[model samples]
Target: MQFFPIFLRSEGARIVVSGGGETALAKLRLLLKTRARIAVHAAEADPKILDWQAEGRLSWVARPVEAADLDGARLVYAATDDAAEDARVAGLARAAGVLFNIVDNREDSAFITPAMVDRDPVVVAIGTEGAAPVLARKIKAGLEAWLPAGLGARVRAANAFRPEAEALPQGRARRGFWAAVFDGALDGRAPEPLDRLLEAHKAARPAVGEVLFVGAGPGDPDDLTMRARRALDRADVVIHDRLVPAPILELARREAEIVEAGKTGFGPSTPQEEINRLIVGRAAEGLVVVRLKAGDPSVFGRLDEEIEACEAAGIAWSVVPGLTAASAAAASLGQSLTRRGRNSDLRVLTGHDVNGLADHDWATLARPGAVAAIYMGKRAARFLQGRLMMHGAEAATPVSVVENAGRPEERILAATLGTLATEIASTELTGPAVILLGLAPRAAARSLPLLQEAAR
Candidate 1:
């Protein structure tokens, strides 16, 4: 970010503006909302400036700005509407060690004003680093419509009640109490008396932590569900898997503690029991824990075990579904997991399990037009190919292996069942990949001129 957004304490501070025309008037309109003491320096003043000066809203000097005038100023705005004059004033402000802004000149300005939604204590500032002022204003307009006009009053009431609310224990209890109060207030209903609310909060049982199994969605942040995003935002501890991408992990709060409990297939991995214990232990400490997994947790993720652990420990748990890798891979291939006239049922299978290469009903899976999305199938390609072929599956059946589905470095390797293992080996697939049995990229099929070529 070129300009970090901060709320400067403007109360009782000095702000200098070196213009008096429309540009200066535009800035003064917003400045008047602040508590800062505004001073305008211009040889000729606008009628509005004269009115404001007469009303004592601001001090206006009937002469050009000078270096001495910038002393003790917290901020200066060179809105002279003339490039040379604005630059000259900017130089003086810089020499005086005051932050200066050149109106409409972002490149030369030390600070740029943000579009704001004013709700008194509930002000929201929207900025684009001066890249898109129109977009910023549009966002401000939307927020202005969404936020309640009475929110400021509610905030004031909460501020007044804060001293009594602090009597509750800190951490989750205090936060929960405040959350309940604002949640009710935002519903537009008349607020309950603060004393009654405080007594009710005190009488309420202590808050207990819970676990949310959130799907991170195939290595893409955009694919994350709003429910999953909210879970991450409120998470106190995030236990994520290896396949969960960094971009998705970045959604967690900065104060959140991140723990990597990745389990790789047939490779070095953290024990499942240990992961379950970690989830239960963290939740037991009254912390909101998020067990973040890639893709749909119920699909291939060992979700049942973690839930069982939580149940045994009497810890509450919930699930937030995500877009699975199979769906993303199919989208990337321009194909569907199931088609009306082709496959009636879609099977989601794992490539390996505790015993070894996971065995499925090869008889049904070998049938013509059978469709399946096989996760963790990269290393088990040869085993899968041999089993399917042994069960009378067609050697020429189309198979596509999608590596890093929905990610920037995604790769789709198209081949027939006959060459599935060979193609996988040749590609040296190193990333998490899914195998789509009986499917090919639609683009690749369309490129073939002959019907027979396209069929293959």
Candidate 2:
């Protein structure tokens, strides 16, 4: 971000503003909310500014700003309306080594103000680096409506009760207490006192850590579920699969320990047993652990083995489902996995397993209008083609391979079952890909010349 948002302590600090017209009036209205000492320098002042000076809200000088006016100021605002005057005042503020902003002039300003939703200690600042002030104001208005008016009072009570809340252990215990307080467990209007709430929290048992099997979703960060996002935010350790994109992994907490437990088709992989042990060991240490897998964990993710390991170790576990690659690939192809008059059932198949090339109900898959999403099928393309054809599958059956589905680098290769193996080999398919059996890109999607060439 070009501009970082920060809340400077304004208490007992001096802020200088160089302007006298409508621009200066607009800024003074917001500045009056702060506890800072505001000083306005203008040769001729607006009536409202003069009234504010009379009301002792700020100090007004009847002259243009000088270099000495910026001395000892925490911040300076040049809202002189005229570009030349604002620029001149800005130069003075810069020479004085003070951060300054030129109202309505973001290009030359050292700092910019953000639209704010003021809830005292719970202030929310929305900034667009001066790119879209109207959008920023819209966001602020939404937040103002969403946040309760009494939120500041609630926060104040919680702040006062913090010392007592600290009696609970840090990490989970403390976080849980604060979460409960904000969730209306200690209502400010309720008869139960904050001290009583603190005592009750202190009496509660300590929380144990658990493992959440989160689906990272087909290499796209946007496809992540809210539950999965929350799991990553709270995770102390994240054990992720190799195919999980780096952008998704970046969502994890900065302090979170990331471990790569990746498995590749026809390539070296971390032992499943070792991965299970790692999950159990981290949870046993009272750390919130996340086993981040690409796509849906239940679908070809070897989820059962890891759950069994957690069960054997008496470690608690849960699953956060993610959008599977099959769905994303189908979406990218502008097709569906199942259609009413075409396919009544949808099958998710694996290309390879412990027994080498995975075998499936090839006869059923060979039926007319049959549809299936094949995972890890890139390396076993020839084996899959041979088996399906041997089981009476049509030679002209449409097949589409989506590489890195839902990702920016995604590619779609279309072919018929007759040329499935050849097409895959010729393409030198790399990256994680899924094969769509009995499906092709919709006509509209085929407008792309590459897909049209493949279809032809």
Candidate 3:
């Protein structure tokens, strides 16, 4: 509340800047960004300023700022390091009824320049009210990285469709149409043809609802992809899974309907058919629906079944891949799933099949130095241990069980294969976990004594 921020209209307006060094040059750089008619009052100016004046970008007064220099100016900058001269310039500007800013002097100025991200017509300004310029620049740097370089071009392209979008009634219909276009186009999804979009809007046809299969990466909300976050923001209905954490779910629009279609091992689960029905049914209501799944939906997430259902229903669908549990678990254990000269191939296996605990090529899996990540393996830990051991796998093979990967409650149990089942049984894990075989926690060497005792 120290200072209120506002964007001044600079087009064709006169702006006077005082001083000649870097401070004046700095203000001139920002002023040049606008279409303002700049005039500099400097006894001796920088070569760049002289060049700019020669190029007709700004007029040079070639003298110190005086009362007459403040006349007819819309805005003025007293950028001289001299405090007395700056105060005089500020007084003259105030009397002339113009906006004034003193460079590096918040108390003496009417306004302060903010860290700005300019995407042509789209401008984002971050100011700390002259309290934290460094922090403001840091934020600007982050925004520069997050925003696409071609955003200005994309925004310009969208302008052409605003008229067409206006064909729809103002309010939800028009906003939804534009939202879809921006969200889709920004993410590289092709927009509908302009004519078709206009016609659809004109006719007031119910916008075809879309189903976004967003991967809520592992369990952390921060792990959610930008695209996934946009999907949640626009979603009218979010059909989420059990493994999808509450924090991620809370990201959805406040008015969005949240439905839990979570499936857990040996627990009451929402039937797959019911989940498909819910997605299709919600989308059919002309609502943007999100099928939020934990980890990569492609990895044992029954994604294909839902996608197939969506296709059958003639609903448009898209997928936003997320960080799967295996990757997060590996990160938690501080080990790579495939290490140089250690293991070249990595197998991601499921604990259960349609019938029961799934069986894999044990011989290959049991090979020394073989590495695999087992998903949904908590209930089948003993079965998996027995099979691997029976296939000539050594009992001393390293195994890491990562529960609640990427979550604050995450636990890493490092043990040899001989005691993986026993260690897993000893702990109560209510969160989805991944089991790493033939790969040990980074601390496995240090925990060897405890691991050996647990096996006994």
Question: What's the CA error at residue 4 for candidate 1, in Å?
Answer: 1.7
* Residue-by-residue lDDT tens digits, candidate 2, 1-456: 998889999998999999999999999999999999999999999999989988999999999989888779999999989999999999998899999999998999999999999888888999999999999989999888888788888789889888878788877777767766777522434434667767788888666779999999998899999999989988989999999978898999897899999997778999999999899999998889999999999999999999999999999999999999999999989998899999999999989889988989999999999999999898898998999999999899999999888888888988899999988888856788999999988867634444426555
Global local distance difference test of model 3: 0.86
lDDT of 1 at 392: 99
How far out, in Å, is residue 135 in model 1? 1.9
Clashing pairs in 1: none
Best candidate per lDDT, number? 1
How well does each candidate superpose onto the true structure, as a TM-score?
0.89, 0.90, 0.61
Error of 1 at 76 (Å): 1.8
329-348 per-residue lDDT for model 1 (tens digits): 99888898999999999999
TM-score of 1: 0.89
Error of 1 at 279 (Å): 1.7
- Winner on TM-score between 1 and 3 is 1
Candidates in order have lDDT scores of: 0.90, 0.89, 0.86
Model 2 TM-score (2 dp): 0.90
